[model samples]
Target: MKILYAKDFNRVLDFLTINLDGVTLAFSTAENDRSFNRHKDYGINNLNSIVKDFNINNIKYLNQIHSDEVLVYRNDFENITDKEGDALITSEKECAIGVFTADCVPIIIVDDKNKVIAAIHSGWKGTYNSIVTRTLEKMIDEFNIDIVNTKIFIGPHIRQCCYEVSEDLKEKFIDKTNIDRDILFKGRNLSLEECILKDVREFGIKEDNIYSLDLCTHCEEDIKLFSYRKSVGTYGRLFSFAFIK
Candidate 1:
């Protein structure tokens, strides 16, 4: 795996791309790049140019309603612009998929053997609804991907140290998933990463194949990544993209 940083439109961005079995899979973070924001139309245009620099064509994005919905991208699927979903999966090499997040988790899954890649946006609602597990299940049922061989990358998000949630929300995760309350909650705070990891492991993804950046968006003040909790209003979003070349 190689980490690289570049300037896009005068804004610095960091990308993590890995070459495995002759396929290049990558995800990126917006480092002090406020222009990469996804909420504004200009921000989306800026993101398109940044993705273009990666030599990716026809990048697919979602309306991202924070639901458990996952879209299986196919060449025949039309209206990519209006698609509303939180996750996207595709085996087509011509199509690259990405998700936007500020403090929410951005997950990328790759099946190198099958050349299938998926991009997931998992917020608290999506996580509580088992979005990652659902996406993996879709890959298995539709694409026949080997869960054990699939590589999962959990990108930068708000970590447990700064991801404090309400007691009701913490209880919801514990009671709903049957995960240990002690494991999910620490002093009235919930660990979203741990919750997602627990579900992924339960789905039979190998421990070693699962990797996490473990960088907290809220804590990394010097990194200049956007954080909704840090600044509720006027905060930007970080884009995590993945595709097979």
Candidate 2:
């Protein structure tokens, strides 16, 4: 669970292989987008081109709805009619999987031995709905993943420094999660990273195994990381993905 900056994108493969023998996970920044069609960039043609870079046999994806729903990826999960979920998972070898997010948290979990991986898109709504918790539960139930042995990584997004909220939202989060209301601020600022970390821990992931990128997209506009709050109507998006080798 190493937090590598985009400066080291060239070394991404190296890091993935060194960290785990059978799997790899990564989060892309705005730099990956050439034309920058945030919604359509991850379309079929684009996904196919991206898949060629890796030796993965198949790539599973989700129509993320920013809800607490966690969908397991198997023939059955794929065959379902209405495709709507916030997370995706796969145990197939060389099976790459992905989930897209702009400023929302990208939650990744990998089981080195079982060769299972999961990717989750957790926005503030998804966070309050406990999407991370549901994703972990789905992993444990569907794949029998060992919570203790699994590795989890939370990618960069809106940090509290820039994620100011209204009092209504703050109180709602506190009531829903029952987190220490003190963590919410007088200015109604909340740390999405901290909230995700707390949820990951509550899901039985160890503190040491949970790594996070404190990069605040709003604060670092120069990096071109998308910030819904910062960019308003001009914001673009990034994708975070994980796969079993």
Candidate 3:
């Protein structure tokens, strides 16, 4: 697997593309010429352009309520509206699944043997609920995926260097994971990435199969990545996509 930062249309837009066997995965950054402010309708054009550029015939996204809800997609499923969930799983080819995030973690999971792919949105609330583990378990139960052969990609997000939480929130993770207080609480903050990785490992995903972009959205001032904590009401979401080719 290789992680690449790419530009298109004469370097007018920037994207993070992950290259894995039989799959092409990507995510847009705030630097893209088109805005991704989902509340306004303008971002739809950018999203459409991306779909066209990637030649994706069908795409599934979510309402993303920060819950652990998982939406499974099949070619036969009728499209009424985008499902309200934090994760999307699909094995169909030519169809892409994506999720939007600013500071939250955007994760992509792929089962190479089964051609199953999943896109997950894990905010602090979702992480506390073990959204990643739930999504993997759903794949195992529904698709009969082998965790040892699956590849997990953790995209750019606010890292521990910049992600600070209140004492109550810190204690919540500690109580839930039973991790040592000193290790869970680093400096004045808790590390969501560490917690999520722990959960993924617990779900039987090999440590070597996991990869992290390690880019901190909030700390990288030079990059035009979105950060809700940094930009507050003005930030737009970054789009993360995954599909089987």
Model 3 Cα lDDT, one tens digit per residue, 1-245: 23333332123247767667788888777775446655667877666667677787877777889999988988877661356899999999988788888899999999988899999999999999999999998998889998889988888798888888988888788889877777767776777777788898888888788877767889886567888898876778888888888
Best by lDDT: 3
Residue 65 in candidate 3 has what lDDT?
93
TM-score of each: 0.89, 0.86, 0.91
Task: State the C-alpha lDDT per candidate.
Answer: 0.78, 0.70, 0.81
Off by over 4 Å in 3: 1-13
Q: Which of the predicted structures, 2 or 3, would earn the higher TM-score when compared with the native?
A: 3
Q: Which 10 consecutive residues of model 3 have the lowest summed lDDT?
A: 3-12
How many angstroms is residue 146 displaced in model 2 relative to the true structure, after the best TM-score fit? 0.7
Candidate 2 lDDT by residue in tens digits, 138-167: 888889998888888787688777777888
Clash count, candidate 2: 1
